[model samples]
Target: MKYFLLTTLVSLAFLTSCRTLQNTQKPSAGAAHQSQEQQYKAAVVSKAQTAQCVTAKINMDVDADGKQISCGGSLKMKRDDVIQLSLTFLGFEVGRLEFTPKDVLVVDRIHRQYSRASYAEVDFLHQAGLDFYALQSLFWNEIFTPGSRDVRSQLNRFRLAASGDYTSLLLTDAPKLNYQFLTRTSSALLDRVTVDGKTAADQGQFVWKYDNFTTLGGKLFPTSMAVSISGMGKKAGFTLALSRLNNDTDWPTRTTISSKYTQIKATSLLDKLAGMAQ
Candidate 1:
C-alpha cells in the first residue's frame, strides 16, 4: 500500500512540471502585441526624422473670443540640422525664424530687425511672454544628436502614444497644458496647447492652438498658430503666418544680434507694463 501511494504522488509531480513548462513556453498574446507596437512606433519616428529636409508654407490666425487662432507658414528642416521658417502676413514680409541646437534667431528683413537667443535664454523668453520651447523641442533630434541630458529627458517625457491615422501623445509635466497632437490623412497636423498656471489677473488662463500643418520635403510642420487668454476678447489674440521656406541653402549667422541686453531690458519693461496695465 505504501508503494502504491508513492507511485501516485510521483505521477502528480510529473504532470505539474509538464504544465509549468508549457506555460513558460507560451507568451501571452497581449505581451506580444505590445512588443510589436513598440517596434512600430520606433520605426515611425525613425522614418519621420530621416526625410533629408522638410519645407512647407504656414498661416496663423488668433481669436480670443473663440479661444483660438489659426496660422500657417513655410518651413524647411534639414535632417540632423537646422530649421528655417519664413513668415508673411497678408503678402507682407513678417520675418524669418531659424533654430539650431544651441541658438534661435528671428530676422525681420522688412524691419531690418534681428533677435537671437541661446538655449539658456529660454527662461528669459518665457518671462517675456515669448516662449518658443515647443518649437525647439519639436525638431530637437535634428538639431542635436539626441542623447544629451536635456534632450533625452525631454524626449522621454513626450512620447509617441500613437501615429499613422492620427497621432496623439501625453506630455509629462504641466498637465494644465492639455497638449494634444493630431495629424490627418492629408498630412495636416494640429497642436492644442493650454497654459494653466498662476498669472496676474490680466493674463489669467490661456489656451493656444497651432494648426494647419503642411508637408515640406516629406515632413509635416505647423503653419498656423493662435494664442488666446481668458477674459480677453477674441480680437486681442495674436496671429502669425509664414510665406516661404528656404531649405536650398544655409542662413548667414555671422551678423546675428544677441538678445542678452534685450532680455534684461525686457524684464524691466515687462515689470513696468505689468504695473501700468494693472
Candidate 2:
C-alpha cells in the first residue's frame, strides 16, 4: 500500500507539471497587445538553457480506506545532470536512490542494502511502473524544459492557453486532473500552478502551491510547496518544506550491494519474475 501511494503521488506530480487551465472571457485588444509584449519579454529573458542544483524536503500524506499515513524525506538534485534522494517512513530510513545520466544506485543505509544499474535501469523502472524519473524532474529545475516527444504527444491531447504573465495550458481529456502551468512573463520557471479537478461530476479537486524560489547557478528552483488533495470521500494534504541546497556536488562514487544481489543476479531475478507471470 505504501508503494502504491508513492507511485500515485509521483504520477500526480508529473501531471501537475503539465497542469491545465480554465476557460476565461476573451481579452480586449489592449489586453491582447500587452500579452504579446509580455511574451516577447519572456522569450528574451527566460532562463531556458541554464542548469542548476537543488535540495529539498518532502512530506507525504497518504489516505486510503479511512486510514492515513505520513512520511518525510530529503532530496538533492542537479538539473539535467544528477539526483540523489533519501526517504524516511515510519521513523525508519527507507533508502537512498541516485541517478546520473549514465548510472543508477540504490543504497539502503539502514539495512546496508545497495543496488546499481546502468542507464537501461531507467527504462526498466519505467516498465516496472515506477515514477522515479517523474519525481526527480519535479524536484530538479528541468521540469520547464521541453518534455519528451512522447510527453508532447500526450500533451497535444489537450488545448492550452496563456494568461497574464503566465501560460495557462488546459487539459480536457482527464477531468479528475486539471493541469496548468503558471510561468513568469520573462522566464520559463513556473511561478504558480493551479490544479482544479472538480466539476459537477467530480466531488472536489486538489490544489498545489509552489513558492519561495531562489536562483542558484543561473537557474531558479522552488524551496517550498503545499499540496492539498481534496475530494468528498477522502481528503488529504501536506506541505513539502525544502532546505540545504548544494550545487555541483557529487554523491557517493560507489555503492556496495550484497554479493547475492549483483547486477547479473538482479537481472536473473527480474527474468524469473517475468517467466512466472507468463
Best by TM-score: 2
Which clashing pairs does model 2 show? 19-179, 19-180, 20-179, 20-180, 21-170, 42-186
Per-model TM against the reference: 0.48, 0.54
Tell me how many residue pairs clash in candidate 1: 24
Superposed by TM-score, candidate 2 places the C-alpha of residue 149 at a distance from the truth, in angstroms, of 6.0
lDDT of 2 by residue, 1-278 (tens): 33423333333423332233356434335868657645543442354325455555666554433345666776766655566656687666665557765565655455454555664454444342324444454454223222232233343343335567665444445534455555555455655545554355544454566678766665666777765545434445555667655464555433456665434344542343233222
lDDT of 2 at 74: 68
The segments of candidate 1 whose C-alpha lies over 4 angstroms from its true place after superposition are 1-30, 47-49, 62-81, 87-96, 106-114, 122-134, 137-167, 173-247, 250-278
Report the C-alpha lDDT of model 1 over 22-140, residue by residue, as the tens digit: 01122225867657545543433443433455454655443323334333445566544466665555575455557665665655444354555664554433432332334433432
Backbone Cα, N, C clashes tallied per candidate? 24, 6
